[model samples]
Target: MNQSAAFSPLHRLWHSRRFRGLVPPALLLVLWWLATTHEWVSPLVLVPFGQLYDAALDPQVFHSLAEGIASTFGRLLQGYGIGIGIGLALGVGMGLSKAFDRIMGPSFHAVRQVAILAWIPLLTAWFGTGDLCKIVFVAIAAAKPVVMGAFEGVRSTPAQLLEVGRVLGFSRLKMLRWVILPSSAPAIVTALQLSLIYSWFAAIGAEYVIGVMSGGIGSVVMGAQEHFRTDVVLLGVTLIAATGVAMNKGLRGLPDYLFRWRTRA
Candidate 1:
């Protein structure tokens, strides 16, 4: 057998998504273990798995982290709902009404151009460094993409489809339900995915910026950092990465699952 032929299966496996995905983390874990065992760096910087286990074993540490995650998730959901609700409504109006678009589009565009983080300070000042501030900031972060997604999606609906809806004597609401929304759903869905991810980012940022006194995963990390609890800090970092990744996977096709009717028309 030729050498290339003999190696083909192994080469293919190396490039496979599942294989590639597993390998980097496996390599990092191996490196982490090696570094810890050899004491390659200061223990204060890179905490060993033993210390991580010890931190996790502490009931106080474990519970605080858990509570923090729960609160963060709660705020994420609330703010996300408010943000997308208004964003979709406004986007639909703008898409359907030239006058509304003209009245609102410039301000919307101008506001979205500002970096999301820039709003944190103003939000914190206006709303106070509490759940209100955090939730509001997250809402702002979640709204922009959703607005654009829904706007473009609706605007891009083919003229033929609208004409068909008209020919069928569909009412405004029926036309929107059967023709406009279905046609624009893909873009809207993509925007939703983006909004969810950005909402999480905003949630964490707000927690960090507005003050952890309110309690959230950001608080967990910040509090641990203040005490120089490197092990707990490492644990918090791991949790953040895991949560973000889980969300990405969990909601990747969410619109398809939640709004199945949107695709059916």
Candidate 2:
């Protein structure tokens, strides 16, 4: 083909959705290669992709990855379960009672503004560097989002529906079961997804700071830093990002599958 025909073919491919999805990553890799080649970043700081892949396949590398994944996921699940459970209960209470919302909301908001890292010193003192500390950190990270989501979901429930339930002589339990829970399901699920993601990041951060011999992914990142292995650091980072994406897919997929009716206006 002549230059014009070639240009047309390129345009068509560029406009294709699947091809478009690949372009940004392809461009980023190219940019990374060029940047590394030109010494735009120090070699110690930015390892080339080839080195990363090679190191990744080594048995030591595989072992570290496996250990890190297991440790991080374990702590995350523990904290996430506790945090979401408590948050949802508190949220329901706050949503139902104006007096409770008035009393608890300010304190809750104040605590939420404090970063999880800031709480590390006190938590470490109380819980030591054990699993409890890490679990607390994850819970702290996950709880706010869950509380906010659930609170909003419950509070924003339609007044008319609540009145209708009262007219039907529904007890408080029946009202919550029939009217509130179903109406709030989407928002609660959204909160769970957010809490889970926050918990994942929190577990890794806690591991990096407090964990020893636990073999969490965060610890792997820490080890990479200690050893000045930028290639391994990047690989750890890549794995975390990939895992987060996978978790998001699984969590969100269930709601989308089961509640297709909710999507309609």
Candidate 3:
């Protein structure tokens, strides 16, 4: 191949979505290194990238991080699972029945209007600094987006489709199964993705607020902060960011696989 031809594909690949997406973070990392190396910021405030990298590799730091991740993940799963169940049920109920909507919609909206973090004080007071409080907080954070997404999905179902189901002599249950659910599959998947993102943030925030004694990434960060271990804190932040990105990417794959027909259409 000619030199131009050989380079052309590489050039195009560099501009592709995945490669483009990496540029900003790469630049930020470069900037961070510059800032630390040149003392643009004090080493105490922003540890050198080299120090952070070294801390991450330390056996003691690695073990603590592994344990923290496992503990946080367990709580996140518990809370997020509960939230999804409750949100799906409420969303479906409100979407399907005017009476149910009238009864529950106002209350749901009212509760949702309050920020999830605002509940932390009350939860802390009620449940103490225990895992229960953190779990409940994560659940609340996860449920709101899910409930709204599911409700919107069901409500947006085409009337013609429902009529077709009726014409085919589908009972309410059958109509729900064949028409409502299939139609709402996209929204449900979107909700789950959003919920997953929210739950991670919530879980971390909850752990931070509850303190290191509670145990998790948040606790690790907080503990590091207490001792002014900026390297460890930055490391925790980096780990959280990387994990969130990986999780989002993983979840994004599911909808693509499940609804590949949409792309073909």
Candidate 4:
């Protein structure tokens, strides 16, 4: 039960994929530092690694980044939560009832075909360039994948198992809770992950296009682009990529724990 024994080198190595993945980037960083040291690449375009790191540490930039990230993450989570909740509810409803599916499936598919970006103008008009607009974008992006995944998951629930559940006096709600939900959990997890990624992308696009005026990673990139500061842009891109990876890992943990029953199933 020793903590050190529990967290061995293998565990450390496994959990350190981010650090390991940084090797190549680290090498590239070294190369860039060397190039800048030697004045090989123009200092104006390719800022030195040290300077980039320094810029990131700058109080103004750091404060801006913190504010931007907090704002964007808040919006993203709000939209994603709404999307997941609604999609899951309706998906279960449609999957459980053939009449419901038949009634709404076509319209759902048709609307889902429309890109999230396509709704930007209307969303802006309705909600303005505020938190609500960003939420709308994130929700639209998150909803479709979740709905699709839920539809497939529910539709593919084993017919024989469902019949058995009905024969056992399982009510519809009981059946969904005990049978369908367990079976479709993996798909649901995948859908959630996809929804998160979609939300992330949608938020970025909305911020970029509408210019939220508030701080966000997208705002940082926009500012950098406006100032012709490619280095800052590169830094923003790197931060975004890093943050996405972290978020993906956080999401993977949820399914691993929630669907642990699958290991036996």
Candidate 5:
């Protein structure tokens, strides 16, 4: 009975998603400790955990991190919402109307081929390196993936599904809400997930490049770099990476949840 009880807990832990996900981080922590302890790298490049911990405990550092995260998340959420909203509408129109597609699709494709960073100069020229510019840049980065995902998803909807919608006398709005969206739930979810990831990256990139001095997580890194604070830099980077991983994990099951009707049927 004791053996069975011990084995049961171990087996459950071994199979749990949280445990599986933690393995890589645990390994990384071990490696980081080994490297720092042995001075495998220059202290300037990688600081010891003790130093990192001390930096985190500092009141000023804590306040800066909190404010930085708040600023960054503010810009991220606003720009991301705007981007995905516009992108979804445009993509759906293109997929639903051949005339609209023919007119806009070519230009969109041509524009997409241009490197994202290349637009920074143009956008900066128009928006003038302020919050507006950073938000616009982040929006642009987020929109592309959403546009592509939504377009492809809608285009791929089965003809039979459309026929069923028509037979049921669904209006355009009804068809879209009931048949189109649900049919393309997986693709839409994928697009949204990718958009979120890209937006976070773009939010940081915009702050780093735009240099608006508005205070973001990117500013923390920039400040640390300017002052040669390796521990602070590591803290900022770890925070950014952790938030991104959490966002990705949180959205991983969305498609399954949204499309459960198919599974049940």
Candidate 6:
């Protein structure tokens, strides 16, 4: 057999979709190394890659990182779950009934216009800068995207499909179960992904605000900044970005698996 005819497993692996996605990050890492090595920016402003890696791996720092991640993840789940539930309920109701849409649409849009951060002060006052306030802030951040996604999904469901359901004499429940829900699955999935991302960001932001008393990755980063531990701050940022990417990939897998047919078509 010709040498070229024999496929190289390593070559194939390198060109694989997952591996290809790492190219940009790898390039960025190289750029970061260059910038730091040449003193494009002072070490104080941008810690060298070596120091950042060392700080990230340090046992003491690792312990704090682990604790902060665990706390933040727990709060993310709590807030995200609550927000998703409420968004789904409202979206479904508004989508299904014209009267409901008319009654709630204006108020919903109006409220959504308010910035997520704006609610933080009121929430802090109401909940007293504890886990509850942070959770509520995260929930608010997650809910807006979810509700919008759900609403758009439901509204965009084809009228022909509904007509088909009607022609088949399907009851409202049956129509919703078989027709509406399936049609809206994609939108809901997208919304879920958005909500998850928003929740993570909100959780971090809330932690940064309340984390001095409470504790999370945000708090760790803030404390590091106060103490002039730039390496630790960079480590926290890296962790947050990596976690966000991991979460998006994980959540995306579900929809991709469930909706494989859409891609096949």
What digit string (tens of lDDT, one per residue) describes model 2 on residues 7-121? Answer: 9978999899989898898999998999888889987878777788899888998888888888888889999998998899888888878899999999999998998799999
lDDT of 3 by residue, 1-265 (tens): 6999999999999989989998998999899888988899987789886788799889999887888888999999999999999999999999999999999999999999998889988998999888898889889988998899889999999999999999999999999999999999899999999999999999999987765687998898888889888888888888889899899889989999999998999
lDDT comparison, 4 vs 5, better candidate: 5
lDDT, candidate 4, 1-265, per-residue tens = 6888878976888679787897887898788888899999776678877788887887887776777778789889999999998888778778778899999888998998897778988988898887788887898888888888887888889999899998999997899889999878788789989999989988888789866585678988888878877777777778788888898889878878887787879
Query: Judged by TM-score relative to the true structure, which candidate is superior, 3 or 4?
Result: 3
Cα shift from native, residue 105, model 3 (Å): 0.5
- Model 1: how far residue 68 lies from native, Å: 0.6
| Top-scoring candidate (lDDT) | 1
What candidate 6 gets wrong by more than 4 Å, as runs, is 1-43, 262-265
In candidate 2, residue 40 scores what lDDT? 93
lDDT of 6 by residue, 133-231 (tens): 888888888888888888888889999999999999999999989999999999998998989998999999898876566889988889899999999
Cα lDDT of model 5 by residue, 1-265, tens digit = 9999989989999999989999998999999899999999898988899999999999998888888989999999999999999899888889888899999999989988988789899998999888898888888888898888888888899999999999999999999999888777688779989999989999998888888488899988898889999988898998998898898888888878877888999
Clashing residue pairs found in predicted model 2:
68-216, 68-217
Candidate 2: which stretches are off by over 4 Å?
A: 1-9, 16-21, 35-43, 211-213, 252-254, 263-265
In model 5, which runs have C-alpha deviations exceeding 4 angstroms?
Answer: 1-31, 38-40
Clashing pairs in 5: none
TM-score of 1: 0.91
Tell me each candidate's TM-score: 0.91, 0.87, 0.90, 0.83, 0.87, 0.84
How many residue-pair clashes does candidate 4 contain? Answer: 2
Please state the error at residue 187 of candidate 5 in Å: 1.5
TM-score of 5: 0.87
Best by TM-score: 1
- List per-prediction Cα lDDT, in the order shown: 0.91, 0.87, 0.91, 0.84, 0.89, 0.89
